[model samples]
Each structure stands twice: as structure tokens, then as C-alpha cells.
Target chain A: MKKLINGADTVLEESLDGFAAAHADILLLGAERKFVRRRTLKPGKVGLLSGGGSGHEPLHAGFVGRGMLDAACPGQVFTSPTPDQIIEAAEAVDTGAGVLFIVKNYEGDVMNFTMAAEMTGREVASVVTNDDVAVERSTYTTGRRGVAGTLIVEKMVGAAAEIGMPLAALKALGDEINRRTRSMGVALLPCTVPAAGRPNFTLADDEMEMGVGIHGEPGRRRVRLASADAIAEELVGAILKDLAPEPGSEVLLLVNGFGATPLIELYLMVNSAKRILEGAGITAARFLTGSYVTSLDMAGVSITVSVLDGQAKELWDAPVHTAALRWGT
Target chain B: MKKLINGADTVLEESLDGFAAAHADILLLGAERKFVRRRTLKPGKVGLLSGGGSGHEPLHAGFVGRGMLDAACPGQVFTSPTPDQIIEAAEAVDTGAGVLFIVKNYEGDVMNFTMAAEMTGREVASVVTNDDVAVERSTYTTGRRGVAGTLIVEKMVGAAAEIGMPLAALKALGDEINRRTRSMGVALLPCTVPAAGRPNFTLADDEMEMGVGIHGEPGRRRVRLASADAIAEELVGAILKDLAPEPGSEVLLLVNGFGATPLIELYLMVNSAKRILEGAGITAARFLTGSYVTSLDMAGVSITVSVLDGQAKELWDAPVHTAALRWGT
Candidate 1:
């Protein structure tokens, strides 16, 4: 596999250094290494924290800014952040209002974030996002792993905290948002980790994987590559069926691309989704089509939908500032 | 050439549908075909509008939340949004406070945004972010095209706008930020555009391209693979020499990965950047290491540095909310 750096070992640290130099507005703190909120916390506003592995760029860290997260702990490539690191981050960003940990539904993430929250002496509330609809829950594991839905939960909960909403209310709001969201993804190609210097999984020239995870984990199944529209139909169908948005109710659509999928493909997929939704008599009120959340170098796409109510819509409309998401002046 | 979609023709539309369904809190404004600020417009706050082609995720659109952009027009993959689309977005989001266009320094983007601004027939302030150090400036073009530095400019300017800063001041601030910022990137493998279904360029197994653009464009040169330390040193050397942040001056660092780079590799590069900066006596007050701005599936990294003074630092610290970035309460 081809890569740009001199060696694989030093990629993450060097990238962090570059990120710091480029956006001096944010602070990097903790020996364990965390992206801490730059603002001096107001005494009573709750602090929000989230994190995961490093390869999913802008997810945990990029989301650290106004109206979102206070801090984000990053782990090694495709590996969950250590409990010690999350604990350090939690302590550093926490103020009197407490901290909310937005944990994705992955086993490693859930476990690590849970451990860190438990270890924190201060009051902390946690919300787990399990919006991916591709996987079915078995007795052995949680239903579906969180994909892009974590972003909505983080934003909604962060906005509540920003306005001084109490911890219980914020948690409740997050849970509601989580309950209203669903996602499903398909992968075109397996990404090669720099350390491994090879594709994670081999694919025949015309093959693709459906319901793939962000870290090259196996998804529902492998299948022949299809047209963008058909793949989108499959993914969107799964998400819509899982979400089952109330008829005529507004919804938020997110057509995300895995790392390698081109924008052309992503746009085509978005077009397909519009047709599919319209055919079902579902009205999409807002659309965010891009690679918001991504798997490293995985050529694929994911569809996410959230049923919106007045409160949820208002929270979603709230102003936010972070490395990754910024809007609404 | 492997991809997950069923067909190329319907990616964008399908993706949009999913995005709208997933993010109902943000209004899609289907008839308008633009993402409007979900919040009721402040009576006299200037609307910030930005947009470009589809591939650059979390960019023009993701930044359209709170405290950043009011609206964004998304075009086809890697292509500039049409002038009509941008004009429509500008008109829809305008609340009598005028609109500002924060445009990256690409030829197509500059032309399209410029046309849109001109057609608005309203008082519109515009700032072009041109901070990539890889290309040199001449009378012929605006020098290096804007890369990741666009994100910083957007955040700072967005924060200013959120606080009701006048359009003139916001434009000045954006221009000043652009002046102090610089970026340079190298690529390991050329990314494949979905429609093309092939890599943009051919690379020998051991070769790398330097100074790559986000659209899979050719870079300054192609060279043999080097060590992470060497690559960091070279990229930093170019950027530092170009911007030359003075000794003891505070700076922001961003070691961004073009999609496909692993975190471990980024971390190693970050360490190398620190060493280089320390040797130069430059203080890195804040650091971000991740893939903030990304080319589709290119395997490479870019380094960015913003020289910061007290005011820039404060503005940077301000809270923001959007799809890609969120922080301070």
C-alpha cells in the first residue's frame, strides 16, 4: 500500500502538532493527550466530553468547540482511547456543572468511556449512541453500533448544556435524540492501516461490503458492487425502516461517505435518497450531504436519519463552533 | 477502482435525502435546495454564506451551523457550486444584515462565489482564503490555493459574526488570518474520483507527491518515500520559511491527514513537528492533530501553522456550533 509519510509510527503525533499550530485557538492538554475546550468554563455550565480512536478524524476532537463537546480523548489508530486518557480529559474539562460523556455503541468505546466516567469523582452523566441500523442486536452484544448518529446527540446535548440545561435534562434530551436516530452503511473497499501497509480485507475487483463499521470491522455481508443508486436504496431502506419517521414529519438526512468514496458518488447517492424518500411520501426538511463521519480510506457510504420535533429542531439549529462543525451566525 | 455504490448517476441526490432525514433539526429547504439556518434569523445579523463542490465534506456545509455560516450551496463533486445556486442561497438566508462569502482560493470557487456575490445586488463582503504555502503567488493567480486554512478563517470570522461584529471587521479579520496562515501537503497515492473510477495519477510503488491540492491535482514534485521525521521536516521547513513565525511567538499547529493516513503516522509526524518548532524556539500554544481538511481518498498529510496574537487567540477561543465543529458553551 502507498502512503505519504516517511514512516507510519509517527503519523498521529505529528498530525496533532500540526493541528495545534494551525488552530492555536484550541488547547491541547493532559499527559494522556486530549483535545480540551479552549474557553474558560463558566462556573455553572455543564462540560461535555467524548472520544474514540484516532483514525475517525473530526468525530470526537473536531466536534470540540462551542455548542458541542468540551473535550475529546483520542486513541491510537482504530483503537479505543485508553480509560486513563479519557479520565484525564474528563477531569481537565469538567467544571462545576459536571460533564457529559457521549459514547458511541462500539464495545471498546462503550467500555472505555464507561470506565473513565466511573473513575471520575465528580458527577458525570453518560449517553451512548447506538444508531447504526445495519447490525441486529444479539444476546451477546448491543443492538447496533453507533455510526454518525453520535454527532446529532453530541450537538443536541451540547446545546442544552450551553444554555445551562441541567444534567438530567441534558441526558434525557440526548437519549431522546438517540432514540430517534438510525444509520446504515456500505463499504466499497477495505482500508489499509499505515502500520499494516496493506488492505484490511481483500475484495474482488467487483465486490463490496454492506453494513461495514468505521474500523474495517466486518459488516452484514459482502456482495457484488452495484450502481450508486441501488446501494443507496439498500442503505437508505435499512435506515428508514429502522427509524420509521412519523408520516409527514420532518427529518434530518445525512449522506456520509467513507474515506475513499468520491463526492461524485456521494452526490449520486444523495440524489437516490431523495427519490427514495419522496416515493415513500417522507419529506426531508434538512439535508447535510458529505463525508461528515468517515472510516479511514474505506470506499463506502452511510445513510443516517433523525426524526425531528420542535425541540430537537431548535437544538439542532443552535449555534456551534468547533474544528469540524461551524455554522449559523 | 473499487467502490460500493450501485451506480454513479444517483449518489448526490440519494445522499442528500439521507442527510435531510438524519438531520431534521437543520432545515433542508427543499424548494430552495439549500441548507438554511434552522434558527430564526437575528433581526440584523449578517448572513454568512459559503459553498463549493460536493466532495470536501464538513466544509462549506458542515460549517453551516451556529456562529459560522448561515447557508451553503453544494455543487457536483469537486466542481464549484453554480452561481445561481449560490445566489439563491444568499438570497434565502439574507436577513437584511448583508451576506459575507468565505471562499477558498480555488479558481472555480473564486469565480463562482464572486459571480454569486455580484449577482446578489446587495451589500456583500467577501474574503478569499489563500493560505497554502505550497504554491507561490504571482500576478497571474492569487498564489497558493486555500487548503485547510479555510477552516480557521471560517471559525474566526464566524465567531466575530456571531458576536455581531460588523461585516467590515469580519472581512478584515478573515483577511488578516489568511495573511498569517500557511499550509503545505504531500500525497502518497492519488485519490480516485468516483465518476472516473480510477486514481487521478499513477504513482510508482515507492513514490510520493508533494504539495498536492484537495482535488487530486498534481503537487510541487514527486519523490521517493522518506521517513516520517524527514517528511515532517520538509513540510515544516517549507511552511516555516514561507510564514516565518518569529521566535517565542505563539502558533497554532495542524498536522492534517488527507484521507487514508493512519493516526499512528500522524502522531509520529506531530512529535517531529514539535521537535522542529522547539529547535526554532517557537512556542506552540495550541495544537490539533487530525484530518480536519481532507482530499477524497488521498493517502497523505498536510501541515498548517497560524501565527497568533492575543486577539486572534481570543477570537479562536470563542464558542462555535455547526456540523463539523462545536465547542465552548
Candidate 2:
């Protein structure tokens, strides 16, 4: 593999060590590497926790800090975190209000987080994110798989929780944000899991996977390569068709990159997606564009749109000081 | 070849459109697509300006904002901005305090920015960065090539300018930081220019380039691929040899990815680099790790070490509000 890993077996733990060291001011590495928690907990505020498989760096772990996640439990590459990691993270961050779990809707992830919530005595709730409309069910998930939209849910709900939102309210807000958000991805190249030492799948140079999963699962279609405008059209078309937001509604547009795609392309996708949204009479009031959610070394992009109310917009604009997303502070 | 751009001929203009739209809150797209300027210029502060080839997204343009660059001129893919574009951008952002240009040390870029500085009527100065130690003279430059260290120069000088440092002092500060900083890059895969439609260079799956440039320019040597720790030892060894920093010098460590590398690998590289620095009796006082300065889609990374004195560290810690780097704001 043309990767920079020292050992495939220790990728997660070593990377977590580096991440914690780099962002020591904002992140506290949990004992035994179960999770990375915020350095300082906000007294009386609801604790926000999230996690999932690794490989998508800067997701749950990088989002842990002020105005975002209080703790994040990371699992092995493309594998869900254990129930123990989730339970310990929830217990560590829970101060007084409660702990709210922001979990992606995968079978393993849902099972583990659900088990943790049941086992923990601390008041706990979870918003299982299933915003991918590309598939009703996938190899790894029974329902629509949560993809890039999970980051949006975490940012929005994390902001709400920062201001002492109750656990119930934070959970409700997360669900509402997840409901309004949708994402679809396309891949030009496949990524390798470190241990596998090979690309998960293969595509010809002139072909593209239309609705690929983050972990390289088969998508809705594997078609001939299309221009960026056409790809944006299909992805945004499906999203708008499913969302069907009211005419003249304002929304936040997110053009996220899968691994290996550059910022220029991500921003270009944003332009294409924005034009489509404008054509549909929706105003893209705010924008977040980058490779925050990624498939490890996969060459592609995902476009996410979240219909925003005044409140959601305010929360997104709030100060956040995480390793991945930080602004306004 | 697989990049998500509308057309190779218009990649710069279209990507600029998307970048401006995504960051409308902080960026002002320049007329005739000459540059991207800050939405709100800070009066009386030295106008910090930078420009370079377009393929390295988020280097100059993404750094244009409150505490960083006042304006950034982006050329077409891997090409330097014309003198007219640079002249126009300098005039646009130059206030009464004058403008300071932070330029990377590529021949075309240096010549164009110098010509623009001579042509522009406004008071202007420049600090050409040449922090790369891989080759004393490479395919692109007469001296060492400026790699990821350019970002550090821009950041530190930009912070100094934000606090109303005069143009002369800012230029000197930039030069000093450039003197103290050293960087070296290695590429695991070659990148394709959109117009070229193929990889710029060839590398077997088992081989790697030791010191590749940001624009696919030839580096010092190629060898069989090795582990991340061995790579880190070689790179850090060369840097410390060139720098010969004091035994206890507190330095800022930047592990920057060349486009296709993921954050996990970058952080893992950082961990390796940090261990080496500690063994050399140096303290990595601060850290900035990301795919900040990238070759379009090259899978690799560059390590930058800038020895930080009190003033430099303070300036580095100062608030910066840009699309790529934001903190303490």
C-alpha cells in the first residue's frame, strides 16, 4: 500500500495518539484510548458525544472541543466502536444535564451505541443519523446509511448543546437537523483499508461509482464517468427531489470531499450544487465546503444540503473550537 | 484526469467562483478574476498579499481573510499569475501602510511578483521563501524551493501585519521566519494536471519520490518505499542538520499533506516526526497539521519545522480568520 502507516494493526491507536498530541489544548485522550474527550467540560450543560469507524479522520474525534462534541469514541478502520468505549465516554463527559449520543445509522454502530445507552446509568439519548438517500439499505446498514450528513448533525446539535440545552432538546434538535439534511457521494477511485493493503474496489479510468458508500460499498450504479456538472446534477437532483423544500427557502450548502479530491474540486462542486439549488428557487444562505467527512484515500465528493431555519443558522454560526471545524471563536 | 472540474481551460476561474461563493462571508472575489481579496480590509494595517499557481488550493486564496492575507492572486493550474494580475491585486489591497508580498521561490512566481512590485505605484516589499532543504537547486528554482514553509511565512507575517506592523518590519519578520524554517516532501503517487490528462511522473507501486515539489517538479531521489518512521527520520534528520537549531529550541511542527493523503496518515506522520524531534532534544511547541499546501492530487506529505522565538511564537499564536486556518478569533 502506498500509505504512510507504520503498522496496519496499530493505525487507530497511533493516529489517536498523534491527534491528541496535536490538539492537546482542545482534546484530552481517554485512558486506554477508548475516546478523546474535551479538555474542559462545561458544567450543567448537556454533554455531546459521537463516534464511528475510523478512516474518516477529523470526524467524531476532530469534532471534540468547545461548542461541539464533549467526547468522541473512535473504532478501528471501518469497524464500529465497542459498547465499552461509548459507555465510558458518555460517563466521563456527563456532568449534570445529561449525555446525548450522535451516532451514524450503521448496524454495528447503532447496536453498540444502543447497548451503551442501555448499560449506562447516566441519562442518555441518541440521534441515529440516516441521511443518505442514495440507498434504502446497504451491505453495512439496514436503513439509509448515515454518511457526510452526520457531521452537519454534530455541528448543529453540538452548538445547541453548548448553551445548556437539555438532553431531550439536544436529541430532538439532532433528529430535526438530520431530517432536513441529505447527502450523496460519487467515487472515481477506491480506497484501501490499511490491513487489507489493497483498494476495496476497482473502477476503470473512464468509469465512476454514482452512489458509493464511505467504506467503498457498491453504490446504486457504476456508470461511465460523467462531467462534474452531470454528477452534481444527479446527486443534487435526487437530494432536492427527496427534500422538496419550499420555494424560496434558505439552506446551508455543503460540498464535502472524499479523500484525495482537492479543495478546488470540492468548491467547484459547491458551485454546481448551488446553481442547481438556485434553479429550484432555494437560496443557499450559508455554505461549508471541505473534505471533513472522507473515505480513506477515495477520490470523490459528496454534496450535503441542510434546510436551515433561523435557529439552525444561528447555531451553525456559533463559536466552535474543534480540530476539524473551528470558527467564530 | 478524474478531477471534478468543468473544463481544464477554465478551472481557475470556475474554482474561484466556487471559492468566493463558499466563503462570501470572508472573501471578496476580484474583478476579471485577478484575485480574491478580503471582504473587509483592515485599514492602516500592512496589506499582506500572496499569489501562486492555482493547483495548490487554499494556499493563497483560502488564506485571504481577517488576520491573514489581504489579497491573493491565483494563476491557472501550476502556472504563475501574470504581472498585470499581481499589479492589480496589490493596488486593490494596498492601504496607506503599504503592502507586503509573501511569495514562494519558484522562478516564474518570483519573476512575476518582482515585476509587479516594480510596476505597482503603491509601496510594496516582498520576502521570497526558500525553506526546502531537499535540493539546493531543483528543477524549478536557482536556490532551494519554497514548499510548505511558505504557508508558515504567510501565517506569521500575516499575523504581524494584522496588528499594524509596518511593511519593512513585516518583510524582515517574514524573511527571518523563512530563514528558521525547513521543509521536505515525499510523494507516494504522481498527480495529473487537468489539462495534461495524465500523471506528471511515473513511480512504481513499490517506489517513492523523496523530495518532490508542490508542482510535480523533480526532487532529489527516488527509492524503494519504506515505513513512515524511516521516512520521518530521513526528513527530520536533513532538516535538523540544515537548521542546527539549539538543543532545546521550541519549534512549531507542521505535517502538511500533498493533496491525496488523508488526515490519519498526516497525523501519524506527525507522531513519527515529533518522536524524532524529541530525540534531537527539540520541543515541538505548537502544531499545524493538514493538507494545507498541496499538489493537485499527489499522495504524499511535507514536514515543516519553524524554530519559534518569543515574538515569532506570539505572532503565530495570534488570531487568524481564514477559510483554511482559523483560530483564537
Candidate 3:
């Protein structure tokens, strides 16, 4: 495999070291090596934490900062973090308000974060984001795998937390956001795991994997690759169908790159998604397009559509100062 | 050959459609399909105009928004925009304060922008960024190719312009940032130009090209692939040698990804670059990491180091809202 890593084992440590140093003002190494917490604790505020496997970057870790996540515990690539790591992170950021865990709908992630919440001995609430409408059951997930919508949840909830919202409110907010969001993706190429030294799966030069998961989980099926507009139509069609927003409903559209896709392609997909949304009479009130969440080196794109409620737009537009998502502040 | 384009011929138009739609609040399509301009032109302000080939995204176009370029003209992939297109963009945004053109050192880019400046009839000053220390001469370039350092120039000068710096002053600032900056890059694989429908160059499975250009221009040389740390040491060592700052110099480091490199790899390189700089006794006062400027889908990373003066730091830290870069707004 043509990968740029010192060693497979050292990739996580070295990456986190670089991450911590780059955002020294916002993020710090926690008491343990597996997690990172906000550099300063805002007294009397609820702490927010979200994490899972490591490969999907700019997710839990990159989202840690003011107006976003408080702490993140990244496991090895595609593996869940231990409960101890989450427990330590929970304890590190917990203030008088309480702690909220935004866990994905994956089996291992739910189990570990649940265990950590029990061990923290602090008032805690948890919300599971199962916004991926790609598949009902996947290799690592029970119902659906949480994907790009996690970013939406983290941003809105983090903003609510920043305003001193209590833990239960934040938890309910996360749940409602997830309930109104849907995402689907397609991969033109498989990503190689550094340790595996081979691609997770092989695709013919003209083939693509539809509804691919973040960690290379099996998608709906493979098909001949099509044009950007066609692909965008398929992905957005699936997401919009699952979402079924009322006509004229305002929604926040996010077109996320599955690592390795160029900005041009992502922009093209965004255009197609917007066109499709407009035809269906759903207004794209606001939109985000980039590699916000990614599977390592996979060339693909994911479309996420979330119906914006009374406060969803406000929270999303609120100031967020994080390594990945930043605005206003 | 796996790409998400409708047709190679329509790539530019479709991508721009998406780009303009996604940032409708800030960006708009010019009368001609060849350029994108700010939605609200700031009358009496010194306008900034930049344009070149279309492939290097978030470079010229993405930088168009408040506090950045007033207009960006996009040509076909890997092709220089026409003088007419540049002239239109220049005229549209030109105010009594005049307009400044930021052009890369590529022969076509320089020649065309110079012609546009002459045709605009408005007072126009131009700065050619030649921060690539890769080679003295290469394909499509005579002296040195402008690489990621163009970003530093645009950002610093854009900030200065926002505060009412005149065209000449902005030109001088762009020149200064270019002079104080140096960059180098390496590519593990070749990128395919959409129009070409094939890889730009060939590399053995275990080989890498050092000093690769953003447009698939031949780099310094190729060698057997090495560990990420070793590669980072080589790239950082070369940039520092070219930039030969004082032992105690405070510098701003930018680690940019060529289209397809993963964040994990980029962060690993960032860590390695930091370590090497520390070993040299230079302090990295601040840093930015992401695929800010990119070649289409080249799997590589570019390292840029700029000596941060008081003014440079202030401008870099200045609040600017663009589709690509934003902070402290």
C-alpha cells in the first residue's frame, strides 16, 4: 500500500500529537492518551463528548472546541474506544450542569459509551444518531450507522450547550435532530487500512459501491459508475425519500466527501443535490459542502438532508470555533 | 479513471454552478460563465482579482467572498483563463481605489493576467507569487511555480484590502508575503486531468515523486517510497533550506494536502514537520492544516513556511469570511 505513515501502530498517536499541537488553543491531551479535551473548562456548563473509530476524521476529534464537542476519545481505525477512555474524558469535562454523550448507532460505540456514562458517577444523558438511511443493518451497526449527520448534531447541540443548556435538553435536542436527518453515500473506490496493507475491497475501474458506510462496511450493492449528476441524483433521491420533508420545508443540506474526492466533484454533487431538492419543492435554506467526515482515502461522496426546525437554523448558524467547523466566533 | 464528472467538457460550468449555488450568500456567477464574483461589490474599496486554471480548487474561486478576492476567473482545467474573462472580472469589481491582480508564476497565468491588467484601463497592480522552491524551471513555468504560498498572499493581502489598503499597497503586501514564504511537496501517485481521461503520469507502486507540481508538472525527481517521517523530514528540510530563516525566527506553518491525501496522513506530516522545525530551533508561532489548495486528485502533501511579522500575523488572524477560510469573525 502506498500510504504515508511512520507505522500502522504509531499512526493514531502521531496523528493526535499533531492535532493537539496544531490546535493548542482549543484542544489538549487529556489525562489519558486515547482522548482529548477542550483546553479550558467553562465552569457550570454541560460537557459534550462524541467519539468512535479513528479513520473517520474531522469528526469527533476535529469537532472538539468552543461551540462544539468538549472531549473526544478516538479508538484505533475502525475500532471502538474503550470505556475507560470515555470515562476519563467524561470526568475531565464534567461541570455542575452535567455531561451528554453523542453516540453513533453502532453496537460497540453504544456499549462502550453506555458503560462509560455509568462509570463517570455524574449526571449524564446520551443520544444515539442513526441518520444513515443507506442500510437498516450493517456489519458494525444494528439499525443504521451514524454518518455525516453526526456533524449536524454536534454543531447544533454544542451551540445549545455553549449557551448553558442543561444536559437533558441537549440530549433531547440531539435526538430530535437525528430524527429529522437522513444521509446516503456511494464510493467509487475502497480505502486501504494502514495495518491491512490492502484495500478493504476492490472495485473495477468503472464500478462503484452504492450506500457505502464510513468504515468500508458493505453498501447496498455495486453498480457501473455513472455521471456526477446521476450519482448525486441517486444519493439525494435516497436521502430525500427517507427524509420526506413537507413541500416547501426548509432544510440544511450537507454534501460530505468520502475522502480522496476532489472539491470540484463535491461542488458538482452539491449543485446536483440542490437542483434535485428544488425540483421537489424543498428549499435548501443553508448548505455545507466539504470533507467534513471521511473514510480514509475513499473516493466517494455522501448526501445529508436535515429538516430545519425553529431553532435548528439558529443553532447551526451560531458561532462555532473548532478545528474543522468554524464560523462567526 | 474513476471520477464524478458529468462530461469532461462540462466540468467547469457544472462545478461553478454548484459552487455559486452553495455560496449564494457570498458568491455569484459573473455575466460571463468564466468568472465568479462577490455578490455585493464594495464600492470605493480596492478590488482584488485572481484567476487561473480550474483544477486547483478553493484556490482562486473559493477565496472569493468578503475580506478576500473581489472576483475570481476560472478557466478550463489546467488552463489559463482568457484575458477577456479576466478583464470583465477586473472591471466589474474595480472601484476608484483600483484593483490588484494576484497571479501565479506560471507563464500562461502571468502573461494573461498582465494582458488583462493592461486591458482593464483601471489602475491595476499585479504580484506574481513564486514561492515554490521545488525547481528553478519546470514545465509551464520559467523561474518558479506558484504553489500553496498564493494562499498566504491572498489571505494577508485580502485582509489588508478589507481595511482600505490601496491597490499598490495590497500589491506590495502580496509581494512581501510571497518573498517571506517557501513551499515544497511530494506525490505518491499521479492525478488524472478530467479532460484527459487518464492518469497524468505513471509511478511504480513503491515509488514517489518529490517536488511535484499542482498541474502534474514533473517534480524534482522520483525515489523509492519511504516512511512518512522520513518524507516529512525531506520536505521540511528542503523548505527550511530555501527559507533559511533566523535561528529564532517565528514562522507560520501551513501543511496542505494535494486533493486525495487523507487528514490522518497530513496530520502525521504536520507532526513530523513541527519536530524538524523544533530541532532547528525555529518556533512555529501558528499553523494551518487542510486541503486548502489542491491539485485535482493528486495524492500528496505540500509544506509551506512563512516568516510571520507583526503585520503578517495580524492579517492572518484577521476576521475574514470566505467559503474556504474563516476565523474569528
The candidate scoring highest on DockQ is 3
What lDDT score belongs to each candidate, Candidate 1 first?
0.75, 0.91, 0.91
First chain TM-score for all predictions? 0.95, 0.99, 0.98
Please identify model 1 stretches exceeding 4 Å from their true place. A1-28, A34-49, A64-66, A70-75, A80-101, A108-126, A137-142, A162-172, A262-268, A287-292, A327-329, B3-183, B213-220, B242-278, B281-296, B304-329
DockQ, all candidates in order: 0.29, 0.81, 0.85
B1-329 in candidate 1: lDDT tens per residue?
A: 66545545554555555444444464464454554443445657788887777766656666776667788787776778888888888787778878889888777888988988888798899989888777665222466788888888887788888889878888888899999998888888777666887887888988888777877677678898787778878888988898888788888777777765654456557777778888888877766665667766677888888898998888777876665566664
Residue pairs with backbone overlap in model 2: A329-B329
| True contacts reproduced, candidate 2 | 0.69
lDDT score of residue B89 within candidate 2: 90
Residue range A1-329, candidate 1, lDDT tens digits: 66545557765665666455444464455563455454555568888888887777667777777778888887777778888888887777777878888888777888888887788788888888888877775222376787888898998888888899988888888889999998888887788777888888877888888888877767788988877667778887887787787778788777777766654456557667777877777766766665667776677888888888888889887887776666653
Summarize candidate 3's per-residue lDDT along A76-119 as a digit string, tens digits.
99899999999888888887788899998999999999998888
What lDDT does model 1 reach?
0.75
Give the distance in Å from residue A55's predicted Cα in candidate 2 to where it truly belongs. Answer: 0.6
Model 2, which residues run further than 4 Å from truth?
Answer: none
Scoring model 3 with DockQ, what do you get?
0.85
lDDT of 1 at B50: 78
- Worst window of 10 by summed lDDT in candidate 3 chain B: B26-35
Task: Sort every candidate by DockQ, greatest first.
Answer: 3, 2, 1
